[model samples]
Target: MKPRTLAGTCVPLCLLTAALNAAWAQDVPPGVGSESASRAGGNRLDRVELNSRQQSDTELRRKSQVAKQIYGRDELDKYGDTSVADVLKRLPGVNVAGGAPRMRGLGAGYTLILINGDPAPPGFQLDQLNPAQVERIEVTKGPTADKSAQAVAGAINIILKDAPRVSQRDLRLGLGYNVDRPTPSATFTLGEKLGPVSVSVPVSVFEWRSLNESVTERYAKGTDGQPSSITQQGEVLNWGHGFNTAPRISWRRNDDETLNFQGFAQKGQWNNRVRYNNSLPVGMPNPEDDADNKGSWRMLRGNLQYNNRFSDSQSIELKAGIQDARGTFNNLNLRSGLPRVHSVGDNQDRSLTQAGKYSQLLGEDHSLAVGWDLEWRKRDETRTTTLANGQNQLPDFDGEPFGARIERQAFFVQDEWEVSPQWSTYLGLRYERIATSSRGGSESVRNVSSVLTPLWHINYKLDPKGRDMIRASLTRSYKAPDLGALLSRYALNGKYPDSSVTNEELSPDRVGNPLLKPELATGLDIAYEKYMNGGGMFSVGLFHRRITNLIRNAVTLETPSFASAPRWVSRPVNFSRAQTSGLELELKGRANELMPALFDPKTALNLRGSVSFYHSRVDALEGPDNRLDGQQPWSGNLGLDYRFSSMPLLVGGNLNFTPGYTTRQTQGQWLDQSRSRSIDLFAQWIFNPKASMRLSVGNFAPLDGQSVTRLSAGDFTRTERSGRSWVGLGLELKL
Candidate 1:
């Protein structure tokens, strides 16, 4: 179905569901819907009884010194989302593209991801993480001195569950269906408290299978000025299984001192099979006719923290951690005339970190904090490719090993001061330094960079009760080049050597530049918030960023040291300056509180909606379609939930949409993407408070297909792909 038709169908169904539920609620007896009603006397429970999570989330947001959005257990479990990416897509001003999360319409690397107040390690995949293991999610719109200043757009922090104060046990069993088969999943959580020690462990195992269909068309002109075209249709089968566990132990020596340990481990494997057929073969044969691929990855991390307080006004915290990760991949491809091509790759990474913070409360209005962070990381990688006869595909770099190391240090200080009953301010400064070195074959490079950033935030309360406020911030942030972008190594194209006979602009060789500099940004943000009774809020925000020394891949014809002939090579370079701005608006509350004329004054209905607009431009690019890469012009989300007054069930659904947009990649290249839409629905039945079951459907009315078009000077390529929706049913038990 078309995207617009699907959206039109799903939105009304959601509103109809809520309207029907509200009508039924109007028939409920007055005393039965009151808070003090007795269940034994056949009285229905009040809507307030189901608002614990909402109340807690709102209170936390209201009391925070920094402006942020918090999502608790309710948001995590409401849609029965299996992955963190799915959960984040419903948030305002956030989008998930290619399994990575983006904020304010900016692409990946603009948003910083953190786990438990620390940076997420390399090779972390948000889609592999289960929501059950998370306690809450925090999203900040700007940079802060206490953390890294790499957030040019924003930051997202995932807080893992901690040791509980009471002993508890819980189990979850689930089954999901996609294209061809049913997949199974299970999770178990245990928590215990003994004297001064507390322990908690949560483990989850899951499996998935999916099928995707794709069609590709390519058009190009030959030396004779004759246009040629080729069309290929293909199918891909993907299967995966994974397991993850999080464990925590806490020891409280006294009220003023504590020690804690947190550990996490994950392992997973995936397999893929592809089959392709040429419907119209008018040009040279394709290199990737049929393929088989398999890969495996694992990660382990452990952290220890200690905290102490010398007096009512003085406190300190120390943290140390170690992490190890590894991955391997193997691929086999069948060609038309040549022998089968086989490739293998392996990579390993290790890192260590230490951090500390000291805080003191001065006379009545000011609180000060100082902190430092230190980290070291190393990576080793090896890759080899050969024909069936054991002949090296690219003889120059085949079977070669590469290594890289990075060292980082940072120090920051911040103070929060209350100037009066209506005004509060935060002032901060941070200094950071990074050094990197890499070696491979006959190439070695080293680079060092340092930055000093200053940040300020001001909050003004419009009312003495502090229920309404305005917030403004000005900060400096930077995006540093990743290890791969800094390493001076050459990566050849698939099944092709660095020769002019087969090289093309669209299929270019890749190399890194060691001399690249970090991209720095100056930003401003303003927001207004109003808090209402019963966990309701209305907010609008605006943000702008001006970035210097923007990093973008530039494709050009060059003869590198590794290649004998002039070939098309794409390299990362700091080429231009850019700017981006956006406006965000969000409203969420009980339906009756938002629209008392339409809904009953005490109806058990809830509503949430948000819309955002984004605009950007690159100073070096041409006019019209010169927006930031992968950024949509606008996006929006609408969601609703209703509880039946006659039954022990709750139903909710959400609709998300992103309009299509085109991006001007370079002087001669342009990229276009199709609109994206998704509709998710869930129903939960509460069988007493200790047992429950949930039924969920994700992407209920999946679009028939999505298309992408890439246009370059005499060449054009377009790809369209389609996949099926998924449904899951799960049961939960608590003891």
Candidate 2:
């Protein structure tokens, strides 16, 4: 059967919502999932007991010293998101394109990701995490003195659940089905408390599958209108699976000292099968190609921290951690029934960090904090390809077997002062230095960089009740070139020696620049917020950023090699300057407080909406009209949730939209994308105090991302579309 069109996909989700409303209009029991012939309803409980935990959390975030937003467990249940990336997509001004989260139109490199206030290791995959293991999520748009100065756009901190005060066991079982495939997931958690010690172990396994199709038209143009053509079409099947386990232990030695240790490990794999057929113009030759590719990755991390409380308002913390990650990829290519070629690639990364912090109360209205951080890292990467044809072996690129060593040190101090009853401010400064060396074969390069950053934030309350406030901040941040980019490396998979074939003569993989500088940015932020009772808030914020020494890909040389002919050597370079500015508006409150206020006193209803608009200009290859790479023009998020007072049922849904934008590529090419959208619907039943069941239809109307790439030389256009959607059912039980 053919897949449904976009319009056809929306009908079922709309009908589902309509059915829910029709049921609410009928006289039915309150708690039962079954339906009688006439009208089935749930029985009312004895009393109207309301728990406002979620509301209270929102209030706390609004009053935080720094500008921030929070998402609690209630929001998690409503959206039924499986991964941190999915959850972050619902926040204000966050973009998750191609399965990675971006903030304020900036890509992942500019946004810092943290776990429990510590930086997540490079190459850490957020999708491997189970949402059930999180207590809350905090999103800060700018860096604070306490955190690193690497976040140019913002930061996201994921706080995991703390050890239970009492012994506890939790089990979650989940099953999902796409129209084309089935998905299975499960998680188990057990916590134990023994006197002064507490420990918890959690494990999870998840898998998913998807299908994609693409078409490309290549044209050879001349001064005349007539053009020669080549058409290619392809389909790919992708499947992935992951298994993760984390164990944490905490020790409390009286009330003055504490120690905590945590360890995490995960293994993930992805497999893809591609089939393609190409048709050539009269004189040109075309062939059918097929390939099977598989990639696997493993990660391990350990953290240890000790905290000591010297006095009422004086404390110190020491932390140490290590993380290691490895990945491997293998592919077998078959072209036009020729001899098969096998290719292999490997990557390894190891990192260690040590940090210490001390905090003291200077006086009645001032607090000071000082911290130091040190990090060491090493990386190794290699790739190899072999052909089955007799006496047809080719030498690898010169930059194979790449390696890098890096070291970073930083020191920061911050002071928080409450000068008056209505005014509070924070002042801080940080100095950071980094040194790196890269070796490819026998050649090597080294680099060193240092920067000093200063940050300030001030908050002014207009009234004694703290109902209205103005916040402003100024900060500086930097983004360093990654290890792989600085280390010269290349892998030529399809090309071979002494081959004149046009299509197979594609460019060889080449890394050029061994010496690259970090990008720098200066930014400003101002916001106004109005707070209402019961955790309601309306906010408007504006921000501006000026970036210098923008890093962009540049072609350094074009030459033929023993392995691949007609190859280009490319490197990242400091190209130009860019300026970006935007505005954001957000609203969060109870549904009953929004329009008609129609819900019962005991019922829980919540609504949240956020929208962001931005524009950026960059001076680069595209001339003065160029915009920042991968920057979206606009994005928005909306959500609604309701829990009935007379029943054990909960219903909610969310929508996320990002209008597409286009960008120019390195080789006189341009790419365009259509608007993207994500919708999710969920209904949960609280069977009892100890057990619950949830049914969720995620990506209910999943957007079909259509990307078109146009080349200038041959006037070629490549169009591709990929879609993702699924339905899931889960059961949770506590003991």
Question: Number of the top candidate by TM-score?
Answer: 1
Q: On residues 1-735, what C-alpha lDDT tens digit does candidate 2 reach at each position?
A: 123534434554465457545655663443444443112232123122223655566677767888888888866555556677778777888887666778998877888888889888876888778888888889998888778788899899988877777898988888766646567888889999999999988888999776676665555432133555566677788889998877889999989999999888889999998887776653342333588899999999999999999998899999999999999999888777665777788899999999999999988889999999899999998777666763333454432688888899999999999888899999999999989899876578999999788999899999876789899999998888788878766544353323322122123244646688888999999999888765678899999999988888765334534533354445688878888899999997766555445764444667889999988887665643267778878889998877654566778888888887887645465667778888888887666677777778777756667676565554555555656566777878997
Estimated TM-score for each candidate: 0.93, 0.89
Q: How big is the positional error of residue 438 in model 1, measured in Å on the Cα after superposition?
A: 1.9
Clashing pairs in 1: none
Candidate 2 lDDT at 69 equals 85
| RMSD to true structure for each model, in Å | 4.5, 4.6
Shift of residue 678 alpha carbon in model 2, Å: 1.4
